[model samples]
Target: MSTLKSRLDVVEQKISEAASNSGRSRDDITLVVVSKNNPAQMVLDLAEIGVSNFGENRDQEAKPKAAEVALAGKTVTWHFVGQLQSNKAKSALSYSSVLHSLDRPSLLDAVGKAVADRAEPLDVFIQLNLTDDQNRGGIQTQNVLGFAEQVLQTPNLRLLGLMGVAGLDVDPRVDFDRIRNSSEQLMRLAPDAKYISAGMSEDFEFAIASGATHVRIGTAITGKRPY
Candidate 1:
C-alpha cells in the first residue's frame, strides 16, 4: 500500500476504536483531514483512500487548492476552518462547501451577503469559545444561542452545526462537556442543525463521547505537516 493508504488505515482504526469505546458507531463520526499547508496532490492521494472530507485554514491557500482538485476531476468536501476576515469571505465562499468557523456577527453578515450573491446555500458552523482565552476565534459561550439565531436568519447560509477547540488548561472531558452543552443550546434554536465538530487527534475520543459528529484530525493521519 502507498504511504497515504497506510496512514489512512491507521486513522480509520483509531476512529473505530474511539467510537467503540464511546458506545457510538464508527460511521457516526466523519474525519475531516486538515490539509492546511499540504499540497493538492496529497489530498488527492488521501481521497483515493476514501477520505472525501478535507479542511483548510486560509483563503488564499484553500482557493487555489480546491480549484486544482476540482480541475483534476476529484470530488472532495472542502471546509473552511480559520479566523476569517470579512474581506476574504467572498474568496472563502467560492471554495468551501462548509464554513466551519463563523464566530462573529460582522463576519456572518459578510458571509451572508457573499452567499446571497453567489446564490449558493453554504453550510455554516458556529464556532464557540469554550475557553477563557480571548485570542481564540469563536463567539463567547453566553452568546452562542443568539449567534445561532442570527446564522439561521441569514439568506443562503444554512446553520449546519457548532465547532470548537479544547482549551489548553482544562481537562479534555470537561472541555467536551462545555462544547456539548453549547451544542444543545444551538439545537434548541435550529433543530435541523445536528453536527458538533470538535476534537482533534489528541481528544477525539472524549469529543465523540460528548456527541461530536465530526472531528478534524491532521498530523495523526497525514504525519507531521510541512511548515
Candidate 2:
C-alpha cells in the first residue's frame, strides 16, 4: 500500500474501534478530512485513496481548491469549516456542499442572499461555543435554539445540525458531553437536523461516543502540517 493509504488504514481502524466501543455502527460516522492549508494535490491524493469528504477553513484557499478537485474529475463533498465573514459567503457558496460555521445573523443573511441568488439550497451547521470564552466563534448555548430556529426559516438553507470544538481548557470527555447535549437540544428544535459535527485527531472517539455523525481529522493521516 502507498504511505498515505497505510496512514488512512490506521485512522479508519481507530474510527472503527471507537464506533465499536461506543456501540454505534461505523458506517454511521463520516470522516471529514481537514485540508485547510494542504494543497489541492493532497486532496486529490486523498480522493484517489477513497476519501470522499474533505473540509477547508479558509474560503480563499477552499474555494479554488474545491474547484480544482472538481476539475480533476474527483467526486468529493467539500465542507467549509471556518468563521465565515459576510463578504466571503458568496465565494464559499460556490463550492461548499456544507457550511459548518454559521455563527451570526449577518453570516446567515449573507448566506441566504448568496443561495437565493444561485437558487441552491446549502447545508448549514450552527456552531455552538460550549466554552466560556467569548473569543470563540459560535452561537452562545442560551441563544442557540432561537438561532437554529431562525436558520431553519432562512431561505435557500437547510439546517443540517450543530458543530463545535472542545474547549482548550476543558476535558475532552466533558466537552463532548456538552456538545452532545447541545446537539440534542438542537434536534428537539429541528428534528430533521441530525448531523453533529465535532471532534478531531485527538478526541474523535469521545465525540463518537457522544453521537457525532461527522469527525474532522487532520495530521493523523496527512502527517504533520508545515506552519
Best by lDDT: 2
Residue ranges of candidate 2 with Cα displaced over 4 Å:
none
- Candidate 2 C-alpha lDDT tens digits along 57-139: 89888888888888999889988888898999888878888999999988898888889865568988899988777877998
Worst 10-residue lDDT window, candidate 2:
218-227
Candidates in order, TM-scores: namely 0.94, 0.95
- What residue runs in model 1 are displaced by over 4 Å at the alpha carbon? none
Q: How does model 2 score by TM-score?
A: 0.95
State the local distance difference test value for candidate 1. 0.86
The global C-alpha lDDT for each of the candidates, from Candidate 1 onward, is 0.86, 0.87
